[model samples]
Target chain A: MTAHPDMHETESSVREFSVSPERLRLTPEAIERRIGYGDESAPDNVRAAIEEMLAVFDSADPFRCGFRILDPGQVAFHPDRIVCGKVIFRTGSIIGRGLKGCSALALLAASAGPDLSERGRVLISEGRELAGYVLDTIASECVEQCLEHLESELAAATASWGWRLSNRYSPGYCGWDVVEQAKFFSLLHENFCGITVRSSGLMVPLKSASALVGLGENAERKDYECSLCDREDCIIRNDG
Target chain B: MKETSSILQSIAQCIERGKVNRASPYPPDLRDRDGADELVRRAIDLGIDPQEILTDGLMTGMKVVGEEFRAKRIFVPEVLMAAKAMTAGMEHLRPFFASSQATHRGVMILGTVLGDLHDIGKRLVGMMVEGAGWEVIDLGTDVAPEDFVAAVERRPESVVGLSALLTTTMMNMKETVARLKEAHPETKIIIGGAPVTVAFAHEIGADAYAPDPPGAVDFLNSTVAEI
Candidate 1:
């Protein structure tokens, strides 16, 4: 996929991508899979709860995403760390492997905003746990959808440069240490996309996601599947 | 009054089917029937021992729910519904427990370790453990290592469960476990979360590792049984 022309403006330029909740496609099957229905259809109560949550989902705040493209000089790959500009991310082997052979990097941060996560938390506290869980799943799906949308845009933006983008890899996944989040955010504008990493490495709003997309003419474009992760206890693995 | 065995069986059934009360419209097949709420109340009014209701009724049904969940016969929504039903019944036993007429199998102190804000998984494990008739003291998310140590200090017999979804936070889990272990070496600590594994559990000196809610319930129950 080719990167959009406008996305290649400058190496240090941080661009915002507007993705509306309306743009997100929350499929019933995807929700079912996440909530542990497996291949079976969700029960009536589950279906009703999902419908209710979906009906009010638009009331949540708008989603936000921002990205900065780093040139080859600004990006350096190591077996144990990835240096983006002056910031060094100790991503370990899993992330280092993915960034191998990359000439540039697209650092992106995306969030479902705070409203949905807050609403879900409130619902759980009120004992509407089933509905709360459904909302949580929806919020997570929203972030994933936002990331997917941004990935496509990045794809179209870099394709002209003959750059192939690998799948997005986020901190706290594939053995990447989340402590590197501080360095990750340093590459972006202050509170870029309205997301902030706490001292604990937790992004405020609780539903935010960040990742690095390696871009190079021959960047293998490896699909970092969750199954490859040995953490058998990982939620995504259990959800599947 | 209904036969004691029959009432207890009904209470178990209500819990298993997620029937909360006669007013609850779930499980369509059991509509209008006396649910855990009514059945448990009736059992108590009949002078049946509260301990029996807890063991023969709530725990009995929750055991099945845990097994079904482990076997994947049911999922989160179903388990959640069942926990609701179990909670409805447990409400009736609260006074008895307070009066020392009934007792929890064991106490569990659970939390998402320091630096981790993720809590849904921890809450799920708490609900399952509570449904299994353990008293769960949930410390919520981003709990400090000292907080865990202090919690276990309050209830020395309590088993601690540390949870974290992020790999970075797993370091915090290790720290929490070490602090708890240092303070109370006898304290049994169990750890679980998306990024947590048996190897990590071993690395951090945790007493056990549970991959899912049922696994947590099973681990806690087994520990108490051993005691």
Candidate 2:
């Protein structure tokens, strides 16, 4: 391939994350904005703060992963190779269940690429290219950490029946709704997404996504291939 | 060519000075002044050419900030302030832009890459490109290689700009560039943001690595000249 003319830039990752939390003194001013901590003065907020940042930290960590591709017809999508879609479910509360499902869907979309067999499985892109280097690492890690958090939370929430989650998929960018995103978001965890919906249902921090994850029996798994899906606007859906 | 004494010179000064309109309060002492918007309109009404206004006035102000930004003399906040000033000036000239009397610096496609959502750098490039007289098509944050490629298919001759704030994502710049080349070989690519450097720009085969928006302007000016 002919090389682009300006490909001469050297990549430099940021130097801030090197310091251990113990070596550094925690200033309220410093950590507050870092984690998007709302009302530092609120009681029980530090736990919330920890929950928020630690969840991001967990998501950014390299996630233990597993994948398999079923026949294209076995999934819910057409042959659009770029769609990242899934269904999610949990044993108990609706919100926690949806949150777990949605996060997995986001991971499937944002990180999963394509399996080598072409049968269809979660695939990671060559690398996450969200923005700049530091920003991408930060966002990618946040997503990974979110899945870990959701998994643990779902474990806690389950009392009777075990829950199962399919893949995660967002709207508008795909064949999903540019409108009705609010209802989709109602099923997510915002602080972890680093964005919140306002009274009008607009997501703050601007950059965010929502998706549907179906919950069902293990035999009922419809491990959908993005290629089989038809959402063209997907930022993650790409085989071309 | 007309001498620099054309009405375009005054219009350029208005933009550089952030004078939006006569009644605007910004630039405190210039209060009750007719800023770039009015100045540009008057110049147009008086038969000063639109292209002249763009090249001479608007481009001049943006070029100044681009230089300041590159030198680190002005940071993000200040450049943003200048951009605000430029916006006030450009509002009245947008129609001329659309009509083609005032041609853009060039068409440039800009965005943050996939798995990345940070938009400050891409957004900055967009402002600077717009300020520099180019019509920008922003794909917003988390742009996929396919998106960039598809957009190039739509506007074949335009320059493509890719931004990444993370080291990890910067690597993906290679793939996006690859897709562009495979599909659009003649297209030029520009890379930038905190994590990028000139050497890396070359490594990815992008045409330019602008440390700041002014460098991008300089690249486009030269590129246009080459064309």
Residue-wise lDDT of candidate 1 within B23-45, one digit each (tens)?
A: 98888899989999999998999
Steric overlap count per candidate: 10, 71
Say what the RMSD of model 1 is. 2.9
- For residues B1-227, could you state the per-residue lDDT of candidate 2 as single tens digits? 35334556666666555555677565566778777777777766777677777777778777777776776544454454456566766776788877876777679988887756666667678878888888899998778999999999999889998887655567778899989999999999998866578888899899889876777777877888998
Model 1: residue B150 alpha-carbon error in angstroms: 2.9
Candidate 1, A68-168: lDDT as tens digits:
78767677889778886568888777667777888888888889888898898899889888889899999888888888888887777777788888778
* Alpha-carbon runs more than 4 Å astray in model 2: A1-240, B1-7
TM-scores for every candidate against the unseen true structure:
0.91, 0.50
Give candidate 2's error at residue B77 in angstroms: 3.4
